[model samples]
Target chain A: MTTTTRGRSDITRLLLTQRIPLLAVLIVVVVVTFFINDAGGYLTASYDFDYMSGSLISAVPLAMLGLAELIVILSGRGGIDLSVGAIVSLSGMIFGFAYGQWGWPLWFAIIATVLFGGLCGAVNGVLVSYIGFPALIATLATFYAFKSIAIVINNQQPISTPPIQELYSLSKSVELPVIGASVPDVPLGIFTFLLPTVVAVWLLLARTAYGRRLYAIGTNDVAARWSGLPVRDTRFKAYVYAGLISGLVAVVTVAQFASARPDAGVSGSGMALPAITIAVLGGVAITGGIGRVAGVVLATLLIVWLNAGILLAFVGNEGSQYQLLALGTVLVFAALLNGLTTRRYGGTV
Target chain B: MTTESLNKNDKTEKNEKSPKRVRVLPAPVTGQEVVLVGVIALLWAGLALSTPAFLTAGSIQPLLVATAPIALIGVGMTIVIITGGIDVSVGGAIMVCSVLTAKTLVGSGVNLGVAVLLSVLTGGVLGLVNGVLIAYGRVHAIIITFGTANLFMFLGLQIFGSGTVNGIPGTLAFFGRGPDGRTLGVPHAFLITVLVTAAAWWYLRHTAGGRHFFAIGGDAQAARLAGVRVQRRVLLAYTTTGLLVGLASCFVIAQGTSTLDQTVGSGKELAVIAAVVIGGTSIMGGRGSVLGTLLGALLVQSVASGVTQLGWRSQLSDLFVGIFIIVAVGADLLRARARRSR
Candidate 1:
């Protein structure tokens, strides 16, 4: 009897403190509901494993940028990067110039683009961490600056050269070689870009001393300074790292689109908001100092699959419109839940 | 009468002897406001010289009309930011208000007053949603507003139904840039914005309730201990922003053509924020003025007009805006540092 009661409490604790488990349950519910709708012939398209797997392509950029925001926000002090979308737009332009306009090798061009994104992020970092600009103002300034440069740099044209067009193969669905028969094929970008980023970010945050320092500063910088941590440098590097990730996302975005569009990142609602939404929904505290890679990854999966289903549920432009509604509702729900969990349990999943 | 004479004598003696102890409100026209005025003057002179048509009524009137919505919203934003919170959903709120009011205008041909009231009420409801969530739920204002921005945008798109709300009536032409929008070469929209801004400036500066917002922003727990209703004040700030947003939407609808599209208020939140920050309002809260916000909006619109008139790429104005933000905020930071050291 005691074991059963203890087990029940353990389950409750897991559901509350661990965002991963809760996200997993939500993902299951979403998938099951979509399946029910599919069975009832209510969907415009089939809601199956193949369609779900195909949709993970969008998660590549979402999760990568989510990680970028996660690191910056983890450094605390009203930390946020409003310029990620702008960085992507600017860096993709540079990538376009290097790979499309110039006759540069693909690997070198990729490195240059990623480094350019890091430079953009570094600018934001120096302004925010060293020069004492507020993060919102600093990033907002750069968001405008980069967005303008991206448009002006190329005279506002997309580069769809031969080599850039070939990059589309990177985002195409690929069948797994060894375990390929039963399961569906997944987008190659998931393996080449997304997995590598997820692993690298996970190892960095989970294993590195810098990550610990970042969290310490985020939780309370004055205390961290008193304890002799290099608070400013740590926070500065977090922005740089976020930029570096944005640089990588630029490459993924370019490959996915099969062309480097000048407004790839800042065209509509912009990529930063969705990335921030993902990070928050993954249970990262907007006030800072608490988040995890697994949580962000799972949250990305949940949103991607849920969006995929929503699209299937509705038709044409209506599908896209409802996607906005779903994203908003889920984000608001998660935020309120974060508040409730923090108040009631003294911690959040 | 003798006690009053005695109190006046005491005040005069205190003012004379303990000058440092005597409280003095800051000057109405601050250094930043003066600098902004000078900069705007320089830009206008330069533009007038470089572009022959810049000083014309055709050129200047539209600029004033365009500046109205942003400056009007900046008044409310100045109050919100002064209270140590932000509302990023204004753009989305604008979309909802404009679309609803546009549809109403297209469908019913509602009179000008009723249309204005409808938009403001819509904005108030949206603002109340944000106020309650932030004040009571205790979520960060940016996150809650961002979520609501999407939701509001969704609501707006749903209202649009098809693609755009076409054939909107011109009942709000008084707020537009045409002859109907002006009297004695002053656009009515700009006139309204100026009057509202002046009123807000007085309310924020001279009133006890206005002082309460600054106290709450400086330190909420301390303000609460000091008998301020911190939550209610915060709620009011957002709601007030909403009411202003509603008014601004009517201006937006009037300024546009007969059709309203989905992109009506895109990136406007950032524009309004840039104006607020440039106006020397502290984003960290507890320090700001609506007067500075008006100057900031004017400077921003001036830059946009200058860039276009110079035949430079229209998008390049954003680069200038970005630079101005850095310079403006950087100057504020330096001044703050000097003050702290002193």
Candidate 2:
């Protein structure tokens, strides 16, 4: 009996502190809850595999931006990027002007847009790492600048030229090649954009010296400097990476919407808030130096599925409003849980 | 020789006493405040020169009225930031308060005092929720407020139910931009903001309680060790911001038309934060000034007005705002560096 109780407590401790495992369990719970609700005839539409697969489309941009935030926040020193949504807006417009108007080749347009995004991020990096501005202030300023420029650049009009409109096929659901008959189709952008970015970020963080240096600097700036790590350069590159990711998100957003909108990323509550929310909910410490790509990916899946279910659970605009509630509740609960876990144990793994 | 020696002894004693007092308090007006005043004056003069209508009462009145809400909330934001905490939920809180207050007025036609009281109380409650979570839960203020911001928006939206609160009575016109909102050429909203800023300025400077806020922000652990009620101070900071947000919502409603749309309080959080930071308040906490925030709000509003008057795209004003924030904060950073080196 004593052994059983100790084993139970250990499992509880593991679930509470290990963010990835906790997220996995929560994701399962969310899906199962929705499935139960559907079986009970509460949902307006069937909450089935196809619906879940289709919902992954929205996760493309969200997961990517979450990863972007993951990189910046992991750099520590109150590192945050409020300008990502704005960067998406601005960079998407640039892509529009390049591909839609100038008729640039598809691959070149994407590369240019991503590089431009990195350039924008470099501005933030200069302000924050080199000039010593707080990340929040620097990004807030850039958010304004980028948003304003995006709107003004195109005179507030969206570009949905024939070529740009053709980009919509990129977001369509496609079946797996070898196992197509057995499973539901998944969004093409998931493979083309989200998966590639995720895998790249994971590899970079897990298998590179630079990633190790980033973690070192974020964990303790002065100590990293004392240890002869290139603190400033590593931190600067983190912002640049975030910017590049935002730029890629911009392209995905453009394809999803079938247009390059001036306000693509900033419409309504803006994308930055949700992305940051996802990152935080994924157990990425706001203090930095602790997070995983897998955690963010799982967190996105949880939110996307939860939101999709909510749409079927409620009628009209209420669904979206409830999504806001769910998001806020989850974030608060996660943050509190983080604090509790820290005190009860050491900190989340 | 005896007189000279006596005078020298007195001078040394005075010098020693003055340095201690100076070290205890920051300068009454910081260098940033001086620069801000000069910038505002310069811009005003430039605008007045370029456009004859820019200095007219028609433009200036609305501008001051517009600045009132941001500046008012900024007073509370100043306090919160001083405590090393931020409440991004002010926008959501504004939504809840204004919507609730608007619905009440539309449904029951309450008097001004009642509407103001209801709004303030609602804001106070929301703020208290944030305070409790942040203080007791020991979570970072940003995360908690971000979460609450969503909850508050949901509440605000639910109260709306369908669309905007149309046909809102003109009971709030006393704080509006109309003839009644002004007294002797000064807009009531702007006047109230000035009074609030002054009171806050005094409270933060002359009182030990105010000083405690600085202590907590500077170093919470150290402050607690010194017997300061760190949690209570943090709670008070958020609650005060809520109360102020409540009042500012009134100003917001008064300044707008009768129809209160869903977008009423959306994004006001960023605007309020921009004003506070521009005013020379440190984002890192432990140091800030309400006076700087007031001036910051004034400067931003002036730029907006000038942009519109100059026939520029309305959105261009945001670019200038972005630039101003960079310049203002950049100047502060440079000054801090200079001080450190010295």
Candidate 3:
């Protein structure tokens, strides 16, 4: 295939692959909505619709987290970020305290939170890149320390988000269309599916010099460093970027849950794996380099869909306990798919 | 390339250099592995003596119990790492196996033999899935195994019906139960661990398949060039580790009730990885030993009991484990550098 065709084909392949996953999730949602409402118009139930909208909204913050780790993995540092969960809890606690008890403005709360996330991520980066600690071990240390720090500050209680009550009341509100009145489709709640940021990340990863640098560094760190790439700086940036994105996740998280739990993302300790699986399934190399943002988005959708579908279909419990099974299956299957792809291509992780 | 061919080429190309006198025989200790292992042992002995309880059997049972699963898991882990792959899903495999035995035997009418066999099967299947992903699916072993860990734990929960299952059939309890009445008066877990370690040592040190793991870990492409069946060895390593973990799970559930919590293996996988690394196994994937892993596990688990028996709270063990892991892993790194330099 010609170069352009290959690029086009890669895009097409990612779309096709992710289409199946997304479709699976969509089908599950549709099926659940249609059938589970055994009660007449249960689909129109206030709580149910609120939950549906709320879930997708909640998913975006996690996707940001998924994206944050995705960028780091794209740099090929072993798809690991042990401090992510802690960072979220820590930074979100800061945001919550500032906005609620401390009375910081909402936008200021976001700015401060994102910066704190970046700072924490930078700390992770320095430890991994400069200090020569293995990504897993260094982050492992930070994981405990960060959470402990947050616990010390928050005293192990969930904190309310300021200005969050507005979003909460809005999320709880059911929009009813009177005979001929049109309601502006659910006033875009704060951080609900921020389209611009996703596009920015996509372009940054796909079309820029820094993006290319990330791919190069990820693909072959030794070669890149030998070739005069700012190895340490690039790495530092990757972790910082992951942290900033995690901060965005923290922000949306506050809005979504309207409460900040210090324990948020404890179960997310192993989350980087699924994120890596999605990135790799979307065609990013685990060793780094040679991937695209489009693929990751697709893979993320696939994972979310498959998981949501499994629950909606009642193939498993529509609860957290069974989510692990669903995620595990997706990851392993994707991994197997990765093996097959590389085997055919004469490559290996 | 054949050694003979390379030797012939080297003679012709380096003929201008000093004549090649009869080569001096290298001492075993001169090898990097021996030197690194020796240094680590020295440091460990020094540390162990500081904690009065670290070396005693009574104080060491907690270590044995904690180390059993990790050591068993590490046995499989060493093979995989030697094959230049890793399986981070032992936690899942162990968790799943622990509960599978419990769920199947407790009030389920299954015989002990069958329940035990099923647990082994559960681990094998989990391993097989991981193996298939690593060997055939072509994903990173670390990642696929990560997912497997999650799936296994989730499956364990689903199959287990949530809360811990208790009152295991008595027959199966021999392996899982304490060594309170054993002839040797040692923790059965410790004995099983030794047996497993010995088996691994024999395999890795004596058997060609074992050598193949090192060959692959050293340089997989070179191993391929040397005509080793890389994929098959990888698969064998994974499956074997899974089997041992199955055994480990039996011991875990045996400790009290056949029932185990889903979190039973939580944080344990990293501990196993740390032990393997501490035991001089390269996380970068080339060298380590069954013996080193045993020592590593002992060192790790002992710290737990040593702290508590010596009167410190048990939570401090995590910090110690982390510190020891850093030191051990760091020592290996320096040793690797020194060896390479020499």
lDDT of each: 0.91, 0.93, 0.67
How does the DockQ of candidate 1 come out? 0.74
Candidate 3 segments whose C-alpha is farther than 4 A from its true place: A1-52, A77-79, A92-112, A131-200, A251-260, A268-270, A315-322, A341-349, B1-58, B108-116, B169-173, B176-183, B306-320, B338-342
lDDT of 1 by residue, B150-200 (tens): 899989989989798999989999899889999999999999999999999
Model 3 agreement with the true structure over B307-329: per-residue lDDT tens digits: 66666645556556656656666
As a whole number from 0 to 100, the lDDT of residue B20 in candidate 2 is: 42
TM-score of every candidate: 0.96, 0.97, 0.79
**Shift in Å, residue B32, candidate 1:** 1.6
Worst 10 residues of 1 chain B by lDDT: B1-10
After TM-score superposition, the amount by which residue B297's alpha carbon in candidate 2 deviates from its true location, in angstroms, is: 0.9
Quote the true-contact fraction of every model.
0.70, 0.70, 0.44
lDDT (10s digit) by residue, model 1, range A235-321: 999999999999999999999999999899998899999999999999999878999999999999999999999898887788888
- Chain A TM-score vs. truth, each candidate: 0.97, 0.99, 0.77
Model 1 misplaced stretches (Cα beyond 4 Å): A1-13, B1-21
Q: Rank the candidates by lDDT, best first.
A: 2, 1, 3
Per-residue lDDT, model 2, residue A219, is 86
What is every candidate's C-alpha DockQ against the true complex, given to 2 decimals? 0.74, 0.74, 0.35
Please state the error at residue A28 of candidate 1 in Å.
Answer: 0.9
Candidate 3 local Cα displacement, residue B2, angstroms:
14
